[model samples]
Target: MQPVRPAERRHETVARLLREEILRGTYRPGERLPIERELSRHFDVSRSVIRQALLILDQQGLVRVRSGVGGGPFVAQDTMPAALAAFENTLAVDPSSVAEFAWAKCILEPAINAVAAETISDEQIAALETNVEASRAALERGESAVDHLIDFHSILVNSTRNRFLAIIVELMSRSMDRLTGTAGIRHLDGAHVLEEHEAIMDALRRRDADEVRALSRDHLTGIWREELGTD
Candidate 1:
């Protein structure tokens, strides 16, 4: 194998360090990262090297560049959705992928619900209730409840206040719509969804973590079987 050049190694090192700092919250969202010249001096690398490193970060949605005076790289917080969309599009995914995604959701969301059972706030519960109600209303009007269903899941995941999990759920929802389209599974009527959601909500309200986890898993599993005809 060809030897890795010193310049390439330096670039890799810089990228790793910067990414770690961002994940560790040292360089938080909206904070201006050190300027190219400053980072170049600090890392003892060339400005070109710094620019290349920053370019990589920008591509990953870790930072954004602005023009004019005082413009510099600022750590960006909008990475998750964009990253998810990019992944889904790149895969050229289809409906069966949605069933697989639903299986994954069963694993992740239950744990998320367990966490929310312990930590979720009353206000968050209220907001989720509101979403469920709205979903029901849409169903009653004989409208598409797909968006509402996605919104309901989005709200539940966001209630965990875990950015990482939220991103996964966001990506899953996108894939889910594709799966539903391919399977020809129309949205569940509002009443049916409301009853299911109410059960989940009741478990959450009671802080019954086990029930919450079980309900979440069963719910996703049922949806997978019903909509995707998956076992």
Candidate 2:
């Protein structure tokens, strides 16, 4: 494989560091980040590279860009929904990226769930239970449980108390939204999906790491096979 160019690597590194800081609460919502010139000086890169990094953060909705007087990248106040939407919009332009995202979820989510089983707090578990009940009610009412189901996975990720995992899984869940959307990729049979969610929650309550991992793997791979016809 060809090596990543130095400029590409620099911007990606900058973006990752910035994302970590943002998620760590180093930057408050609406707080302006360091200017491009300042960041370029700190990183010893061109201002253009800093611009590229800012663009990435903007696309991820971690930062919003404004121009002209007093305009720069600032921490987003409500980032989760915007991040998911922005990430999904990016994936929509590249059909192959959807498959790539699926594979990523398969690999990452199970590990994330395993961590959550060990680290999850009582409050997080309660949130998850609430999500499950909401999903069940929606299904019973003949409404789509897709949103709740997506939220269920997101809660599991957040339960890990790992901000990076939360960010990655948030983006993946939105791609899943597209996969289960009206495009007919495959409609998630709510009843069956709810059963799996309930099972996973039970394992989480028991703090069964191995069981959570196994259940999460099965749950995700089941969707992969059903939707993408892949193992």
Candidate 3:
């Protein structure tokens, strides 16, 4: 028999190889990988080692394991949440990174908004209008509309119809959420948020890309400046 490697090293090696394969599209997302027995034979390791390696991949959100009649490892359907969680954890360790993120959003979102203005459908505009109206009503009822307001940005990203942009913006939004809880260093007044969103929505409705760009720039600048206490 070949000399046995330590279990830890064996599992880590297996996990690394599987992770690379999944990322390289050898195993597509949501596709099932081979059974533990098959994987063990393929890697020349014990089933326990395969399980341990799978556990590592699961922790990293590369693959998911299921149990029962239809049980085995499968590549993750959506990896963005895992990536965002990792980014949020990193920002948590250095709260100062929040300011850097704010600057990035300030620079990126306005361009995205301009692009969205050029291509956004009428249905999308209606959605933004509805969100803005919801915030307005919530504020009038003396309720906090913070969560609704945060979701406005998400809706805007969706209107862009760019999958990659959606992932990047989602990552930034998650990081911001971590840095600023429900009521943290930069709590946006509901009334102000409504007004800003309304203006941007109007520009989008007109399909006026330039106006949307300017309004979005102003809105993000206000938020980032307040959040970072910068000019």
Candidate 4:
């Protein structure tokens, strides 16, 4: 392969450095970064280069620059919405890819239940119960329970406390929203669904990893087959 050009290499270096520091929690949420002069000096680059780097970070919603006294680039506190927006934008450009994303989720989410069974806590279990209750209420009121459904799955993934799994679940939730939106699948009552979720939750409560894994797989498979007609 040919060597990278100087400008391209510089951009890659800056982006990688910033991304590493962000992931490492060196620059925490709501914490302002040093001024452009300081960053340029530290990186041995010009202010323009630092500005370009910051711009890229800003686009990724990792940082935001404010203009005024005592203003600089601060780490963004709410990255989820930004991440969701980015995913939606990509789906808009390639609508057919949404189905493939949904298929991937059908495989991945049930597998995460095994992880949750091993790692979940009582507090997480309580939180999931709360989500289930909220979902039931939404259904009773004839309101769209899509948000609650997303919340329920989010809680399940978060209960695992695996960042990688959480990221995958987040993407899957967005893809599900897009899929249902296009297919006109409205929110259904949680009366039946809650039992399925409760089975997984109960397995977690009992610390039965195998049962949790099996129940989760069966639940997701049943739902996908019913909704998407996919086996």
**Model 4, stretches more than 4 Å misplaced?**
1-26, 40-46, 126-149, 182-186, 225-231
Residue 151 error for model 4, in Å?
3.4
Which has the better lDDT: candidate 3, or candidate 4?
Answer: 3
Tens-place lDDT digits, model 1, residues 1-231: 122246667766787778888999999999999898888877788888778888888878888888799999899967765576665664464534555666776788788878888878899899888888887788788786666666667777888878877777767666565545632235444466567778998998898999989988887777667766667
- Residue 41 in model 2: lDDT: 79
Give each model's whole-structure lDDT: 0.74, 0.82, 0.83, 0.75
Tens-digit lDDT track of model 3 for 1-231? 122356648888888888888878899989999998888888899999889989999989889998888988999998777898898888888888878878888888889989899889989888888898898888899998887788888899888999888888778877776677632223777798788889898888889999988998888888778766889
Candidate with the greatest lDDT versus the true structure: 3
Minimal lDDT window, size 10, model 3? 177-186
Ranking by TM-score: 3, 4, 1, 2
Query: What clash count goes with each model?
Result: 0, 0, 0, 0
Cα deviation of 191 in candidate 4 (Å)?
Answer: 2.3
Question: What tens digits encode model 4's per-residue C-alpha lDDT throughout 1-231?
Answer: 122245665655676687788889998999988888877777777788878888888888898899999889999997877787777887778877766666676678878878888899989989988887887788788777666765677788888888988987876676567656622124344566677777777888898989987887777666665666555
Q: Which pairs of residues collide in model 3?
A: none
For model 3, the stretches where C-alpha displacement exceeds 4 angstroms are: 1-13, 24-28, 67-71, 183-186
| Model 3 quality (TM-score) | 0.83
- Among these predicted structures, which one has the highest TM-score? 3
Kindly list the per-residue Cα lDDT of model 2 for residues 129-207, writing each as its tens digit. Answer: 9999999999889888887887788788888888988888866765576655632123768788889999999999999
